[model samples]
Target: MDRLDIIREDETLEDLQINGFSVIQKKEGFRFGMDAVLLANFAKLKKRDEVVDLCSGTGIIPFVIMAKNSISKITGVEIQDEMVEMANRTARYNNVNDKAYFVNGDLKDKDLIKTLGKVDVVTVNPPYKLKDSGLINLDDRNSIARHEICCTLKDVVEAASILLKDKGRFYMVHRPERIADIICEMRSYNIEPKLIKIVHPSIKKRANLILIEGQKNGGKFLKWDTALYVYDENGQYTEDMNRIYYKRDDDNE
Candidate 1:
């Protein structure tokens, strides 16, 4: 068995140990560690909410959810055994073992859904790279985590649809280029894309990513706008981003 290592962070986690935080290689391939935190912060978690994070790696999103919202319970679905193992360790370390657990299986599998039941909300920071669109990473773990090998964007939205209850919410992040495809896919599944926030590197550059929120079996009313510049021209974090990730109100007295 491959032993896991802890991922120490500076401002984000501080001493919070990610005992099992590492890349995992499965039949499909590798993924990144930071994807967890990105999705965690994007989920807009609420109290006592039943949340499920699909394609959860190292259980980062679930752990983050636990930290921010103690009353919510999370179930993470990960296809890789190694990732699940690490999430288990992290869960124990964080003392949210009972609140969150991981299951090993592809997100597209039908049989696996029975165990998780239905959730009030589902979040996925799914694979963004197209298999043939970009150079394939020789590393299996890295390749699969970024590229759409096992599940495409449509497949992810479909899975989220099935996993959620009627009117349940689905939140996710994807490449800005695929915004049209995302809107079409969600609408086809009766999951109305209600909220959207376009993510950009700086105020000067075009958007590269977008955070979208949809509700299952919802009306066709779409609501969205830009999240604004995350960084300044000097490449430093902007005021809004600082308030978000750091949870600080710099404008406060």
Candidate 2:
């Protein structure tokens, strides 16, 4: 199929701004956010490591990792069929299908988990709010992406644990208010929390997001990295933020 044929009427092709990669995003449905970008950056992977991303909306996390890492394979598990189709088309557009793909199946499905087998790394940017906690979006897609209508926090952690190889790494980005719940779930599945970084909108603001990394069947020690401020006091993107977004070159610093 031609490149234009891959996109649908309701979808827009947005530039990822990395290695000439772009993604197909629904104009009104759930789209990639800064949290997903931050989570992808927070993950550390070895060469040839296989990675899986749970709740991979539009496969953004997987694509972001592909831009930065030389991993053997990366799979994105998304429950939404439309998202899976769009993501696969984007993969073909980038000619990265040999190394990256998206699966249209629930992460909590046992059969899907069996098919995936073991992977070296698992990353998730799961729904941060409980189903009943906040005002849910009227759109079913947005609601599922923002609230735990399908998979809860525990479910995400358990799936990651089951899919990970021994000592495999797990990375996630979530709201700071849920830090306690995240730690509890990770530990319950033997995914030890090893590193954490709080993300603040600015220096004066309290942290609203957190980036966490864990290891399966690993140690008990945890280390806190330097806090990340997205913007400077002058309301400009911080140097670190600019680098993460690929807006600045490392050599220039």
Candidate 3:
């Protein structure tokens, strides 16, 4: 069995001490901070709807969604057993274990989709590339999380198409360079790219990431926006980001 490192723990949430679990990353690689928050905050949840978050690392996305909306139920699927276990623990700690379930399984597995049936919405922060598209990490977890070692974008989209209903929604984040391929793939699966927004680091920089919402039976329409400037050449989050990061939920009031 692979051993895990624990850096610290509060009463509820625990941090992954080592950078082993890049998927759920507590400290290092791709922690569920800006990207996750941006997606969750941008999401418009519907009442009495079910959401399935594919590749739901530490269950942070679902947790945030549940906090903001009153949905029917939320389900999380993670390919890694350790990640599933950790997410289950997070559910328990948050007292939402009964409302959500984390299962360890592959999205490409058809049987798993049949058992879970259809969902209203599905979200994913999938692996970026063709595994070796970039330099692979020495650590196994980080490598898989960053690269498409386990499943590719096509796999995620196909699985989501199978898991969603006729008009179900699929939300995802991916590199902007692959825009054409992603649209082609989604359309092939009968999932139309209903809306899309390209995320840029700054007004000066070109788009880096694409955030999209696809519907099972909807047509093509793209909406682009300039979001999140992480640096101003001096390597600090720009002023707009400060407001986004620190601002509380306006709907709360």
Candidate 4:
């Protein structure tokens, strides 16, 4: 067996054959889901771009983007030590250690923010559930990942604002219920909300996810892209969804 196979005993390696990119996720506890994939695909990254992913669980966002884009460097800031270690291992296994890195640090820390300096793009798949609003997950990892246990919505947006260069783009995937909150928080920091896409599970249901982008110090104009439906009537992926899932090369170019 290959070294990856041997090391993957306690984890599951998801292979994206498009660019030979793989992400190693824990067998249990805080595994990435479709949200991370959507955010990666949703984010607009260019070649040799300096990117940062906040609340980057296992570095899925950076790994997925690096697979398709020729990024100069991408750093993932995660609060969880285990996730950071796992992400670094995945980076090495994928032969992208030089271009990708994972650091264990709280995004709310100004010191950590200063060390990162400026970046071309900032992406976040932040905790969607507000603290004290809903039931918290029993698992410690999942609790921190899903709920605003470590950081709140404002904190995530502020971190992104601090990390971005002037006119730098910030992309995030969040629950639809918090769209107003997201827009407000972003605008409060001079990160103008410029683009948005609503994601629906099916045509019959309401949108549950919002993929939004803002430009630091940008003008106040919001463009709403066509809505995305994950499934068609027969419970299969829609054409756009298929393109989203598999259009690794086309979108990157």
Kindly give the number of clashing pairs for every candidate: 4, 0, 1, 1
Candidate 2: residue pairs that collide = none
- Which parts of model 1 have CA positions greater than 4 angstroms off? 1-38, 137-139, 247-253
The C-alpha lDDT values of all candidates are 0.72, 0.91, 0.73, 0.89
Global lDDT of model 1: 0.72
Give the Cα error of residue 165 in candidate 2, in Å.
Answer: 0.4
Over the stretch 27-115, how does candidate 1's per-residue lDDT look in tens digits? 23243444355556667666778888888876656766666565468888887677887677666655567887888888888777756
Q: Encode model 3's per-residue lDDT on 160-225: one tens digit a residue.
A: 998889889888888888889899999999899887877777668987877888899786675665
Q: Give stretches of model 2 more than 4 Å off.
A: 137-139, 249-253
Candidate number that wins on TM-score, 1 or 3: 1
In model 1, pairs of residues that clash are: 29-141, 30-140, 30-141, 30-142
Candidate 4, 188: how far from true, in Å?
A: 0.8
Q: Each candidate's TM vs. the true structure?
A: 0.83, 0.95, 0.81, 0.94
Alpha-carbon shift of residue 6 in model 1 (angstroms): 8.3
